[model samples]
Target: MTDARDPIVRIEGVTKAFGSFTALHEMNLSIASGEFVTFLGPSGCGKSTTLRILGGFETPNTGRVILDGQDVTALPPNKRNVNMVFQDYALFPNMTVRRNIAFGLELKGMGKAAIAARISELASFLELTAYLDRRPDQLSGGQRQRVALARALAPDPALLLLDEPLGALDAKLRGQVQVELKAIQRRTNKTFFFVTHDQEEALTMSDRIVVMNKGRIEQDGTPEDLYFRPASRFVAEFIGETNLLTGQAIGRDQDVTGFDWQGNRLRAIASPGVGATATTASLRPERVQVAQERPGTDNAVQGRVVNRLFKGHRMLLDVAVGNTVIQAYTDTDRGRAIEDGPVWLGWNANSLTLLAD
Candidate 1:
């Protein structure tokens, strides 16, 4: 059993460079045992590079990688206790699902019966028992991905690295697989290090999320932490839909910090060193309540509804406040009642996050 309190993987001041370009800049991260940690960022943000280094496919230019209690920075791919599930579902084309899953066990020279048992166990766990005899080309994308997962999990490695493993599936299939993957992780109780550029995927699947930008870790926290209390402007904008308003911090009263935006006074949660500094407030679209009459809130703004988009259960309204546009979401009935006209948007102080500019 994996110890939840122990650090399964510790990346200490790791840096990677490709000639003049630096891919990772003194990156430091610690992943707990049996935790589902996702490295989230856009392309060229060093998420994949970090995964590659962890998998022993690429050597870091500096620092050390400690797996469990030992330093495995210099270890080769085969010598390390980590397995990777690639984006393309890298399964042998000629082999059946059974053979594909048993490939690693066969290499380890396990008894034929033992290898068969392992494959059977993994297939059953991943819901692939029905497709055990099928080839890679004969199965659907989701099935093939499951087979690939079974192959990786058959050897029972200490950590599983998933590099955009669901990138090939369609939107609906991807959602289905995501739930299955999380269930499988819980059932196996193994450390998972997932890398992806999709923010929703990261939020939905991670125990903790490490958001990267320009080869550096911008923020690392739970999905709720990143969404509700973003540390930086990049994190505020990257993690989800948010309205950013640039203002000058005027003063503070206990836990409330006041800011001056365009001629309006706005208050947010207390900010450290907020007095006299330029600050930005991040408000989620759903947090802003829209109505014809002014609502009871710490802050209220009057604006003209520029556009309204019906999104099934909810309606998205683009309201223009001064020169900036604020996006707000409301129930379909309430939204249609106040469509394309002047409206008042209000939000409580707790909903507004004050960020350093």
Candidate 2:
């Protein structure tokens, strides 16, 4: 068994460049064994490039790739003890599900009996026993995805790299597969390095999220950490729907920091190194409570509801506070009652996060 304390993959000062364009810059990350670390970012943001480097499909222009404390920078894909599942579901069209999954084992020179047993085990685990004889053309998108996963996992590699494996599935199926995938990861205790631009998917599946932007890692933390305590404005804005209020840190008291935004005073959780100059505070829409009467909170603002959107369980309202519009969420009843009139929005000081602008 792999040691829990040891990181399975160590990316040390890795940088990638394509001629004049740099794709990744001095990237350093350590992924522990059995971690579900998702590389999240928009397209052309080097998430895929990082994954490729790890999988040995693309080598870094500088620095080393280490696996289980061994430097593997010069290793090829087949020699790296890693497998990747692509967004395209890269299955052989003519091969049966069983055959597709067994191909890797066969190439590894596993005996026929061992290959059969491995395939049977994986098929049962993935609930693909019934569809083992079917071709990729006969399977649904989710089923094909499961087969692809089975193929990747068949080798029982030390690391599994998934590059948006659920991108091909429909929304409902994608959600279902995400739950299943996490369950499988927990059961197998294998390190998963997933790459995707979908923030929701990253939040739902990752043990830790690495948010990348423009060839660098903006932030790396748990979903709650990234959402509730974002390190930068890009992280706060990229992770979810948030209101970034531009302000200046006036002073600090205990754990709370005071801010001045457009002649309004606000308070938020304080951290070290926050400058006195202009900063931004990220407030989640759900954290902003709306009511007809002013609620008892340290910070409360009055504004007219400029726009409202019904989202089944909750309603999203855009409350115009001066020239800036603050987004708030409330239950359907309260949202419907407020309509287009004036409303009171309140939030505790702890709910606000002071971020570098």
Candidate 3:
């Protein structure tokens, strides 16, 4: 793995416009070599635009793009030392698997024997050794994807770009291939710039995530940081399931603040420079505890049972208090015979996160 500060690709004040509308603002970011970074968001959040800019498919209207200390802003896609895997797995229908994997090497003027050797090496690594002579149409979706990946890696590019590469796979196969892709990246020590709209996929595979909205970055951090310490309400609501508590600041100190929601009062620890005037709080579903008896805390509240869902390993409870709904997660092993009899909801001091902006 590469150090986070040692950037291999840097974008400075990069902006893109489509005639009148701006697709990307003056954005700036850095991706380290050998880092598995993902650009994650909903559709039309400029995630695809950023990927296209990095892949040399689109030029930014302003600012520069640097790759490995070299300026590549005006370079065409073929000149940039990067490879991209598309969502459709663009394989040659007439070529065999071996030829598809060796196509890049052939284009680079490598000897036929060397190309064959490299193709064999890559096929073995991807466990496609037995399907070398089969065409893409003769192989399964996962096999064709592996062949596409092998072809992209044959040239040993400095960066690999994946644009929803696994979107075409079935859900069960997608999960299986995610494990395989992570393993391949680890074994090869390659830098990956992946784009995906699936939040769970981003959380599962990325070393760091950049969440974008409206052509600008909303939050950039590790999965744990985004999940546990969201910097804004947009991040708190977008990255995961969160119960928003409308509250008003009651008291403030250097490192703590008190908030009042309805008749419930809660204290949350904040940074030294943070203020107590925050108007909202983000409570994660896992942080809320549900029980038949109260835990004797200042954060406890009384709510009526609106719905209960029994998942395989956990139970999801939706409780309504006034106009607000609180979601609580209870493990299945915690006894399920309690019914809807007087539910008590509580969360610890650390679970309450103040949100602003």
- What TM-score would every model get versus the actual structure? 0.96, 0.96, 0.94
lDDT of 1 by residue, 1-357 (tens): 337898999999999999999999999999999999999998999999999999999999999999978799999999989999999989999999999999999888899999988987887788899999989999999899889889998888999999999999999999999998998899898999999999999999999999999999988889998898887788899899999998877887888888788899988874344345757889999999998899999999999999999999999999999999999999999888896878999999988888867
lDDT of each: 0.91, 0.91, 0.87
The Cα error of candidate 3 at residue 285, in Å, is 1.1
- Top TM-score hit: 2
- Pairing residues by index, what is the TM-score of model 2? 0.96
Q: How many angstroms is residue 223 displaced in model 2 relative to the true structure, after the best TM-score fit?
A: 0.7
User: Pairs clashing in candidate 3?
Assistant: none
Clashes of each: 0, 0, 0
**Model 1 TM-score (2 dp):** 0.96
Please rank every candidate by lDDT, starting with the best. 2, 1, 3
lDDT of 2 by residue, 1-357 (tens): 449888899999999999999999999999999999999999989999999999999999899999987798999998989999999988999999999999999999999999999999999999999999999999999899889999999999999999999988899999999999999999999999999999999999999999999999988889998888887888888999999998788998888889887788988874334465647888999999988899999899888899999999999999999999999989988789886878888999988988865
Report the error of model 2 at residue 125, Å: 0.8
Error (Å) of candidate 1 at residue 85 is 0.2
Name the Cα RMSD for model 3. 2.2
- Give per-residue lDDT, candidate 3, residue 4: 39
lDDT of 3: 0.87
lDDT value for model 1: 0.91
For 222-299, candidate 3 gives per-residue lDDT tens digits of 998878777678888888899988888789665557888887778765422336677888889888888788876548
